[model samples]
Target: MEQNLPVACVDLFCGAGGLTHGLLKKGIQVKAGVDVDPACRFAYEANNGGAVFLDRDVESLTAEDLASYFPRGSYSLLAGCAPCQPFSTYAKGKDTTQDAKWKLLRSFGDLVRKVQPDLVTMENVPQLPKHAIFNEFLEAFDGYHTWFEVVECKDYGIPQRRRRLVFLASKLGAISLIPPTHEKHISVADVIRDLPEIKAGETYPNDPLHASASLTEINLKRIRQSNPGGSWQDWDEDLIAECHRRDSGKSFRSVYGRMRWEDVAPTMTTLCYGFGNGRFGHPEQDRAISLREAALFQTFPKTYQFIPKNERANFTVIGRLIGNAVPVRLGEVIAMSIADHLKMVNKAEKKAN
Candidate 1:
C-alpha cells in the first residue's frame, strides 16, 4: 500500500509457487500463497524464499482473514486461480453441479470484492467461460478493466505446449498480458535433453536431481507400443481393450503417446504416469515419463527443494503437484506485464498530481 513498497500478490490455489516464482522475478513482492495440499508447503516455502505458503482450501477464505494479511487497501493485488478440474477437458460432459470446485470461481470473485485490491488475475482452462458460475463472476466484477484470452505456454517461452485461459483485472485502468516472449518456440530437448538417462525403474547416479517413477510390466509394454506424438491407434489391435472397441471410445485419443524431441511437450496432467492418461511417454526413452522429466516439462528449477527425497518424486500426490503447477516461465511473463503496468500507473499519477 505504501508508495515506496513494491506491488504485492496473494496467490490463491498457488501450487508449488510456480506463478509466485515468476512474479517474484518481475519485481512483484509475493505476500503469501494459499493451497489445500500440505505437500506443497515445503517446496513452495523453500524455493520461494520470503513468501508464506498456506495449506488451506480457498472455499474457507474470509474477508476478516484476508484483511488481517492486508490492511485497508494495503494489498496491491488479490490474485486467485481456482483449481481447473471442474471445467477441464477431462471432466467433459460429466455432471459437475454438485462438485465443490464449481464454487471456487465465484468465491474468488467474492474475495476480490472483499479485498478490493488494485489488481487481480486468474488462470484456468478455456472451457471455464462456458460455466454459469464463471458468467456470474464476470457480472459481479464490473467496472474493473478486464481481459480474458486462451494463451499457449510455449508462446511465452515455456518448453511445453500447454494452453490456459488467463484473466487480468485492474482498477487502475485496462491491462493486457504480454505477447509471446520467444518467436522460436522452445523445444523439449532445449530443457531436458542434457539430463542423464535412467532405466525403467532407475534414478540417475551422478545427479541427485534426476528422478523417474518406477514402472510396472504393463506400463513398459505400453510405452514400447506407443509412438512419439502419436496415439493409442498405434497399438496392435489385440492390445486394444473392449472399451476401445465400443462405440463410445473412438474419440479418446492421446493415450500411450510419446513426445517429439524437436517440439514442445504435450500438456502435463496429474496422471502423467498412466500409459492411458495422455501423451506422456518419454520422447526416446523406453518408459513413461519419470519424476525429473515431469518437473522439467513444468519448468521448475532443477535445484528446487522438496521434503523427503527425489526417490519419492513420483508418488501420486507429489506428481500431481508438479504436473498441475503453473509453468514458472509463463508465470514470469505475467509478472513482468503487471509490473510494467504498475510503473505506468505510478507515472500517470505523478504527472496528474
Candidate 2:
C-alpha cells in the first residue's frame, strides 16, 4: 500500500451512525454504513458526510459488496458492533446461542476473513469476552496484531456509566486504545442541564426528539416524590408496586429512580425514555428523561437528526437507536488510536526503507 492514501471505512450494523459520526469528527472518511434496519438510513446518511447507508443484513453481504464501498487503492477499515442482546447481561444466562443475532458476530468474522481489511474494530457489551463465540471471532485476526479491553464509558468522557468491549486489529502492526480522556468524570448535569425543560408527554417545540413519554397519574406522583440519586424506596409507601413488596423486588431498586445531577447516568437502554424502565427520571424535571436527553447521553451532537421531517417520533423506535448507539466520544477515541497506530507504522517503514 502507498503512503498518503485515504483510509476509508465501512461500518456494519451502523445504528444511527454514532460510530461513523465520531470517526468523521476525528477526520476519518467513512464511506458507507450497512445495517438491516431501513429506519437507520435517514439519520446515517443525513448526519454523516455523504456516507451511503446500505439497508442490508450483514449475513447476506459478500466481500465484493463491501470492497466496492472503498476508493480504489485506499486503505480499508471494516468496523461493526453486532447486535449484542444475546450477549448482554440483560439476557440473564438463557441459552441464547441459538438466537439469530448470535450468528451476526460469526458473520462479521467471515467478512474479515474474506475482505481482509487493513484495519478492523468492533464494540460490544463487556460480557462478550467470556463467551466461546468471542474466541471464534478473535480467530479471524490470526495474522493481525490484536488488542481489546473492557472500557468504562465514563472514563472515556461519556456521561453515562456504560461498559463495552473495544477491539482493534491491524495488519500493519500492534494497536491499542488511547488512555481514558476524563478523570473527574462528566456529570449528567454537564450534558443536559442547558436543554429546555418540558413536562411529561410534552415535546419541545424546537425539537421533536425532545419529547418525553407520558406517565400515568400514579407514576407522575411517584416521580414527583422521588429524589435525585434515590430509588423508588424513597417514594411514599402508597406508590410502591406490588413487585417491590416481595423479597425479589428489593434487588431491583434501580428502576423508577431519578438521575443525580452530580453523577453519571445508568446505561441507557432501548426503553430509557420511560421513567419506569430504569434510572431514567430527570434530576430536576417532573418527568422521565426525554429521547433527546438519551441521545445526548450517548454523546450525539445536539443537531443530530433522528426522526426525519414530517415523520412522527416513536419513542420505541428512536429510543432503541439512541440507546444502542456507540457513544460518539468513544468513536473519536477509537479513531485516534487507529491514527496513532498508522503514524507509527509509517515512520517504521520509512526508517526501514
Candidate 3:
C-alpha cells in the first residue's frame, strides 16, 4: 500500500470503457478491459489511450489470461460491472434466474477467488443485492473487507436519476465510495442544452451521434403537444394511444412524456433514444433525446469517441452501450475512493513502522 507502489486494474464486462476511462482519469493504471462485444473494442481502445481491450466473454476468461496483462508484484485490482438486465426491475416477476447472464456473477466470483487481487469492485442494478446470486458473490469475499450501497447517480454529478448498487472490497483494508460530490442534482438542461439542435430523424451533419430518431406523424404531434414533466395524461384525448385507454394501460403513464429541463432525467434504458421509451422526449424539442444526448446524460464527455469517423451512428448498438454503461462520474468516485483508501493505508503503515 505504499504511495509510490504501482496499482493496476482489469475491467471485466467493460462496455465502451466508461469505467476504464474514469479509472485512468484518476491515475489508476488500467492494463486492459475484457468484454464479449467486439463492437466495444474500437470505442474502448479509442477512448482509453493506454488500455488494451480483449474481446472475450467472462465465462471463458481465466486468471492466467488476466495475469498476462499486468506485471508481477503490482497491486492488482479486479473490477467487473456484469450485465444487470436480468436483475433489473424491468425483469420483475420474470424467471431470470435461468438466463445465461444470471451466472455471470458466479463466473466473476470464480475469477476473483482464483486471481485474489488486492482490491475488487462492482456496480449493478439495485435489484441485484436481492438475488441469491448476489449473496453468493459476497461469499466469495469471505476473508476480505467489503462495503456496498445503492447510490444515487445524481449525487455523484451524473445528470440522470439512476440508482445503482456499488460494491468495493479489499484484502488490504476497508474501503467505501466517496461522499456525494454535488449537493444539488444536475438537470437535463445543464448537460444537453448547449448542443446544436436537430429535427426529428435528421442527423446533425457535424456530429452523426447527435442525430434524432424519425418520429411518425402522429408521434410527432404527440411530442409537440407534450409538456415537459407532464405525462401522456396532459396530451389531447385524441393523441392518447388506444392501448392507454384500456384499464391495464392506465398505469403506464410514463410513456410519451418529456423530460423536465430543470430536473435530472429518468434512468437511461437500452431504448432511451426511442421517443416511446420512458420519459425520453426532449424538454423543448419535438423529438426524443438523441444518441449523443443520451451519452451525455450518462456522463460521457462530448469528445468520447464511440463510433468510427466514417461510420454513421447505429441507434441499437450505441444506445445499448450508452444505457448499459456505468456513469463516468460514478466510476471516478469509486476510483477516488480506492485511491484515498490506498493513501490512508500507506499513511498508517508509515506511522506503524
The best candidate by lDDT is: 2
Clashing pairs in 1: none
**lDDT of each residue in 98-187, candidate 1, tens digit only:** 567577776788787776777888888878776666767887577789888999888888887788888988888778998878889888
Q: lDDT of candidate 2 vs native?
A: 0.90
Query: What tens-digit string does per-residue lDDT give for candidate 2 at 67-133?
Result: 6787787778999898865433445545554556678998999999999999999999888887767
Displacement of the residue 138 alpha carbon in candidate 3, Å: 1.0
Candidate 3 C-alpha lDDT tens digits along 1-353? 23567789999999998898888888888999999998899889999988999988798887889887667767789997988555334444555556666778888998898889999999988888776677778888978999999998898899888889999999988788889999998999999999998889989888889989899999998998889998888889998999999999999988999999899999998899998988999999899999999999988889998898968999999998988888888778888999889998888888899
TM-score of each: 0.89, 0.96, 0.95
Tell me the TM-score of model 3. Answer: 0.95
Where's the lowest-lDDT run of ten residues in candidate 2? 86-95
Among residues 3 or more apart in sequence or in different chains, the pairs in candidate 3 whose N, CA or C atoms overlap within 3 Å are none
lDDT minimum window of 10 residues, candidate 1: 86-95
lDDT of each: 0.76, 0.90, 0.88
Ranking by lDDT: 2, 3, 1
Give the runs in model 2 whose Cα sits over 4 Å from its true position. 1-3, 87-101
